[model samples]
Target chain A: MRLENVWLRYHRRGPWVLQGIDVRIGPGEVAIVLGRNGVGKSTLLQVAAGVLRPGRGRVTDRPARVGWVPERFPADQPFTVTRYLTGMARVAGLGRAAADEAVTSWTDRLGLAAFRSVRLPELSKGTAQKVGLAQALLRPPGLLVLDEPWEGLDAATRELVPELIAEVLAVDGSVLVSDHRGETVRLPAARRWLVADGSLSEETSSTDETIAVVEVAVPAARVAGTVARLRAEGHQVLRVRSDASTAVSQALPVEPPRSAGAARPAEPPLGMAGELTAEQPEAADDAVESAAGETR
Target chain B: MSALVRMRLAGFLRTGRALAPLLAGLITLGTLYGGGRAQPAEAYGVSAVVLFPVLAWQTKILLDVEPDVQRRLAQVTVGVARERSAGLLAAAVAALVTVAVALLFPWLVGGVSGPVDPGDRSIPVGLALGLWAHLLVVPAAVALGALASRASVGGAGYGVAVLALGGVGAVVFGLTGSVAPWLAPPIMAAARTTAGDAAALTLLGLSGWALAWSAAVVGGYLWRRRAQG
Candidate 1:
């Protein structure tokens, strides 16, 4: 999908929320829209989602199926969770049987199974956001646009979001998302489009600092906690392999310091393993298994 | 579109927004036909005239039931045109329900009295003309509702004002339509035609005027939405 020199204003004499914005995202691509508050990030996402038509230019080659999830799902309605999703599925062109199946599947997948019969207006913010996600994914859309999707989500669901984005991309769908919480770090490879002054500019991803990979060994029970800490600290965990040599053996490769001035003395548990040249997958299956095992 | 219509109707019913206009319509019908018997066509003509505002109000209520965000979601799910048409269709369905109740209310009150053209007894002329008048008014009323919809004009207060004014215009100008019939919906003409011995050409003309008014209002509404977008 492509927006060609699009311009938009809410009212006839209103200031332009978006001006001369030209952006394109292809199949299998994800674009993360970044901007400060009230900078039209939501407006840009809305335009890309086809919710708002640009006053000046046109959005061309928009996919037939576009899944749009707003920042806040308006759940103050009369329908229950299941009923609402089913209705949305049918609106998205699913047949009755298919709509039901999709609703059931999505509700369960989003951890909303227990709330299937619960009314929307009674749901908490987090649960409502999950519902919003489920409705959008009822049918795998060719273009998925989410505005502040991470807001009001629990930790587990927050992690599931990147997985959902990956699923859409796996189907060769394009995704446009706006983020404020920096949770988008999970999508390290997503293209970043910064919105400022009612215009969008793409940011290049290039860093030239020297790199180092530090390997750390922690107890099996602490493995999950340690990995979480490392990731939170801006260090990338490369791999997690169980060791039969001891109770458990884990290898964590940490990224170089964010800045040269922040270099510090090495810690005991963390030792500098040789710098790894290649980037590892963000969510390795073994890492997930280790985390789940720790939880269990 | 069907999904949207169904959702809107469900919302309309569940929200209880359908009650005020419905109760108002029933009460008005009861008061109009209470303990009084008249020619079916004439009574129904007056009934149709009063029901015009009621139907328009109901349509507006139905159209405005869905919140803006949900409506946007529907628009994204099924394009703008389909979503919009769904809202209008839902409103039309609500208007039809009111029409059905009005049609039956008089009979429930034992208000019909009269024969057809002195030779025909197969179909009651009052009933036929009542149905015809209602059919004639539905499009125009729905259009007025659409014009006064929250989508067309922002804010609840403003929408109500627009609808009330439009309803009054349709009634007043319809009654005095001889001065400038094209300025308002042909509702009064419909009632007059139903109550009197009207020619087939005249009936066709009323239908044309109603349809033309509906087209203009709906067209302007769709254009406004597109422009606002």
Candidate 2:
């Protein structure tokens, strides 16, 4: 998909939210969009998703089936979770049986099996976000655009988000996701696109700073603190294991602290093995199994 | 496009909001039926007074059931033209029901009284013309409602406009003894039905006027939407 020199404003006299922005993402590539608040990140995503038309220039080669999950899903509708997902699945071009099966599968995968019959308006924020995610994935979109997909999600579900992205990528689909919390480190590899001042630019990371996936094992009681400490020390803790065992392992980068002041000591902390493992970007399955084994 | 139309139609039908049109239609039918032994003019006046505004208001309520966000989302799936067509089709359904009830009420309640011209095979012809004429009100009122919505007019505002327009049309037709002045479908139908001479020409003229008015209103509405977009 490609947007070539797109310019957009809400109204004829309104100021432009996006100006001369050109970007493209090929099939199976994930593009992580970064920007501060009110910097047209959502607008860019909407234009790319075909929800909004640009005033000048054009978007070409967008897939017929594009899935878009807005920052806040409009969950005040009268339908139940299952009904809504089924309707959306049909709208996205699924057959009756396919739509039903997709709805059931996505609801279960997103941990919304219990809320399938529950009305949308009655759901909590996290549950509603899960429903939003499920709807976006129900039809296996050719291009997936998500705005703040991680916001309001529970820890375990947040961990599952990367797997969802990987699933889409495995099907040769393109994904464009916007995140403010930098949680996209969980993605295997992503091209960073930064939006500022109504313009977009691709940011290139230096080759010297490589991201490594580390497996951490800690007691269940210290899981939250361990993840927080890893994050505080400038290590991007991707996911924490969610099994019924005393030991918990997290996959995180082995990069040093971003800031000199936040740097940790040369030695790894107690009960936390910060071994410098090689870059195993496609080792998500092995990581899950290792985390589960440590818990046993 | 069919899916969107079905969705809108289903949404309109499955809600309590659908009752507004039904109630308005019932009231119009009742008023027309109560005008027993009266001339067709009385029936037409009653229809104008009660049916037009209420039907317009009911259509507004039905259309409002799909929130703006949902509408926008649907528009993304089906283009804007399809979305607007679906909404208009739904409105037309409500209008058709109301008009059918109004036109058929007289036959249902018992044939019209006090008017038996042996040469006047024009009653059925008049009835057909009237049906065609009155059906035009649906598209007109829906177009007016769409324009009102675009202008951000509240429901009460559009309702009042519809009622006032109908009332003024009736009053003007009464004073002029000509349906052409107001372009009011009900009044034109009534005038044609009561007119003993050249009823066919009058019916044709009335149909032409009603259709022209409907086309103009709906055309203007489409123009405004395109302009805004």
Candidate 3:
């Protein structure tokens, strides 16, 4: 699916929220939509889902079998979670038995079997989100548009989300999602797009392309070896420090930790000590547990 | 055409959920002392008949059940603009329920009350069709009341309240309280009129208005679907 020169505004508004935005998600490709809040990230997702239309431009190649889950869902009915998913599947034109079977499979996969009888309003946020994603995936829609699919999930389930996306792509389905958290995963690896300043910019990168600039300070004699190792590992390595670190020197600057199931290292980046990552098994676990306690 | 229309009919039949309460309410209404000797135009039973039908139309979409239905309805293929099936089904349910309530309820009530004559059968039919036709306004009201869905503490309570309000309005307008019935629909006005009466203009006006309402709502659905952020 693709949108070209798309412009949109709401209810006698002055300027458009989206201006001349252009994008395309090829079949079987996973495109990660990135943007700040109110930067039209949700709107962009809605347009692709056919919830909203481009005001002055054209949207083409949108497959009819598209599945979408909006950010704020309606939870006002007496429908049980299973009943809800089956209903949607039937509405999407599946036979009743097929719809029921599909719902059963997805609910089991998403770990929602325990909550199947619960009404939508009673489920916790994460559980409700699982139902949302499950409904969209119930019938294996050709195109899946998700708004923050992994938001509010616990660690283990968050790890499973990218796997779910990967599985979808493996079947030749397209996946488009918006996630503020930086996530890295293995399949169909994704191209990123930034929705900003009333427009969308394709921030392109791929698995084969170099992305990181790793500056290293080793013994002058070992610098060449360090650079070679980094290059062989597919890193965009840069040499910032020519001399080795002394006893008092710090190895690298620290940044905020990525969410669990994301790509942040298990231990601190090579030298920050136990407080950072849980790298060396036992001691690392203790430090992580302590950090989690401090957070609480 | 058959698939869409047939689905619409079967979906409309599922609207029977609304009848559960309506039948229960009828039992209570039967026990209550009705305005027994009042003119046919002043019947309170008129409103009671249509209440459940409207309620049924509002809640049957199953969108309220799974996967964030309201957003899906308004923003996805399940909603009216994305597909005609839901909208047509909604309308058919409303119309059928209206006819059933207007004709059947009055006939049932009159039989129980021991009326000698059929007591203005034409008028009740007109009133029912008119009211049923008016129900086309419902989906727009529901879409507008998107916020109410949250405020109702769930959805069941709000659905009941909305049905009551619509039913009450229909009954109140039926009172031959004056030419006021003329403003409601041709059916109600024609009920009290003699054959070839001058009030025939009211029927034409109401039918035109009803048709216009249908066009307006469908048109709005299309526009809202096409509109962007």
Best by TM-score: 1
How well is each residue in A1-296 modelled by candidate 1, as lDDT tens digits? 89999999999999999999999999999999998799999999899888998989989999999999999999989899999999999888999999999998988888999999999999999999999999899999999998989888766687789999999999999999998655576677799999999999999875732223333444567667767766665555544435422212221111212433332223333312211111332322232322211100
The 0-to-1 C-alpha lDDT of every candidate, in the order given, reads 0.80, 0.67, 0.54
Better of 2 and 3 by DockQ: 2
**Which scores greater on TM-score, model 1 or model 2?**
1
Ten-residue region with minimum lDDT total, candidate 3 chain A: A287-296
> What local lDDT does model 1 show for residue A229?
64
Which candidate achieves the best DockQ against the true structure?
A: 1
List where candidate 2 sits over 4 angstroms from the true fold.
A208-296, B28-50, B103-127, B150-229
TM-score of 1: 0.83
iRMSD computed for candidate 3: 5.3
How would the candidate models be sorted by TM-score, starting from the highest? 1, 2, 3
Top candidate by lDDT = 1
Docking class of 2: acceptable
Model 3 chain B is weakest, by summed lDDT over 10 consecutive residues, at B144-153
State the lDDT of candidate 2 residue by residue for A156-269, as single tens digits: 788888889988999999999999765676663889999999999998875533444445455566677766665555455544444422222232222222432222233333
lDDT of 1 by residue, B9-104 (tens): 999999998999999999999999996877777777888888888888888888878888899999999988898899999988888888998988
What digit string (tens of lDDT, one per residue) describes model 2 on residues B2-106? 556666666676556787668767766776676564434334434544565566666666667775656656655555677678777877777777777777677
